[model samples]
Target: MKDFKVGHEIGKGKYGRVHLATNKSSGYIVALKILLKQELKHDKLLRQLEREVEIQGNLNHPNILKLYGYFQDEKRVVMILEWASLGTLYAQLKRQMRFVEKQASRYIAQIAKSLKYVHERHIVHRDLKPENLLIDKQGVLKLADFGWATYVQDFTKQVKLNISLKTNGYNTHNTHYSHFKYSSSLKTICGTLDYLAPEMVKRQSYNEKVDVWALGIICYELLVGVPPFESIGFPLTIQRIVLDEVMIPDYVSKEARDIIIMLLQKDPINRPSMEQVLNHPWIRMYNKSSPQNSTQTKLTKTIITNINYNNC
Candidate 1:
């Protein structure tokens, strides 16, 4: 492990850098995410790192990143994960301009299935966007980066608080007021602004539904080559999300628009659940018409080429 060859710096984030490394013993290529120990000293960041490992470890789906193992020295924490040779979905989309409806549907369905598993396990992946999704050489999508995810049980409890005070000269007696208690609201705004749900924009209490909203945005982007609510800046973007300002491009198929609208509903309660999304008419039709043979052939060739290249 100490003498492992680091080929290239594949990615970097707030926590640390990710490198393509080859394990000498097993002769396997792995994506190594290195986090700075100093940064992890902060309670909040440490919790996020721990949660990422926990959530990723629990997810066994093909659409989610596979966590192999982790190690820590005095300076850094190194996490070994599945290597997706093709790189991020964002780069792929950028290269292709946009994806066909059938392709988009297949990828989105896989992502929905991943989210369904996460939600069922009482974990919310607060940040899910193209940048966080990786495509392997096989063209399979793997959801990555769980820095903003949190356990549902840890966030579902309501807290009660009462305040008593005497205000001004007019108030001679103690006045007590009780704040209405709801589920523990996530306070940190840790996602890309463009994909945030309406409830998230308002800083309201949210759950797994937020991930649905993000998927909708991803769908829209895959169809229109950009997000549905693409604004000039953060303030304008937040304003648009808060105002429910969204439009389905004319080029987008009617079925795709319908799915997007359902997922991007202003009310989180009204948004389609992951199961409903999977069963949606648009998804069903797309799945039926998917070019399985073509996709499979391309994927096989790509994976074989990458593996052979690595061997060389």
Candidate 2:
């Protein structure tokens, strides 16, 4: 941390600020996340930071940002991560009203693959949105921000380690499965309002299917230029999510509509698994060389042209 020279502030969050930093040791540029120790002492936020670092460290994929290292001093905790030069997917999408089907598919496919990997390991990324998806200089989409994630087994394991005391002031066998059950249920409500699953809005029991619902929202937004359930305000949006209200604009393609329908199912049990999603017709169309290459060429030109015009 001492060797690194912190540059301009890139982003800010409630808990901390992210700075573009140069690692003097390796001469590598990285996004350094610095959080104050007083902020972490809150217990809830500290646990979140630990979970994010732990999960991100374990995950290694081309579509996931790499974590370099972390150091903590008396005042702050610093985490170094791969610097994505091109900014966020949200910014890129905002610049271009909506992405063509081929362009959206490539990015969604990469995210689905990453989610599939994380889900298989029993990790549920409670937060997945365009803002959390970063674009590298090479135009690859990477899944970032694991601060809201949790391990399914870790909760159970922690419960087992703590025993309940008897009423007679003696140690007794813990019958606290109900406690863990409630705790697990609460975590589902920890996701963002715009991208939260139906079950998450209802504060009911859910699992990895929640991520699929968010991905579905991301896909819909990609196709139609706005989230299907989003309204003019946060309250209205929350109401729609809780009430299972969604609107699909006529401009959205049938292929995209079908995929969205399957993913946005009210019942988490009925939603398509990540693997099934990967092989879905809409996704399969993106894998073909002809369509993929053609779309990439068109998008690359469009992006370059827009950048040049803006520079002028």
TM-score of each candidate structure, all chains considered together: 0.82, 0.81
CA lDDT of each prediction against the hidden true structure? 0.75, 0.74
How much does candidate 2 score in TM-score?
A: 0.81
What are the runs in model 1 whose C-alpha is more than 4 Å off?
A: 154-184, 289-312
Model 1 per-residue lDDT tens digits across residues 157-273: 222211112223232223232222223365556699998888877877777788989999998899889987888988888888878547877887889889988888888889988
Report, for all candidates in order, the number of backbone clashes: 0, 0
Which model scores highest in lDDT? Answer: 1
| TM accuracy, model 1 | 0.82
Q: Which stretches of candidate 2 lie over 4 Å from their true place?
A: 154-188, 232-235, 289-312
lDDT of 2 by residue, 66-128 (tens): 665566544667777777888889999999999999899888898898899898988888889
lDDT of 2 at 146: 86
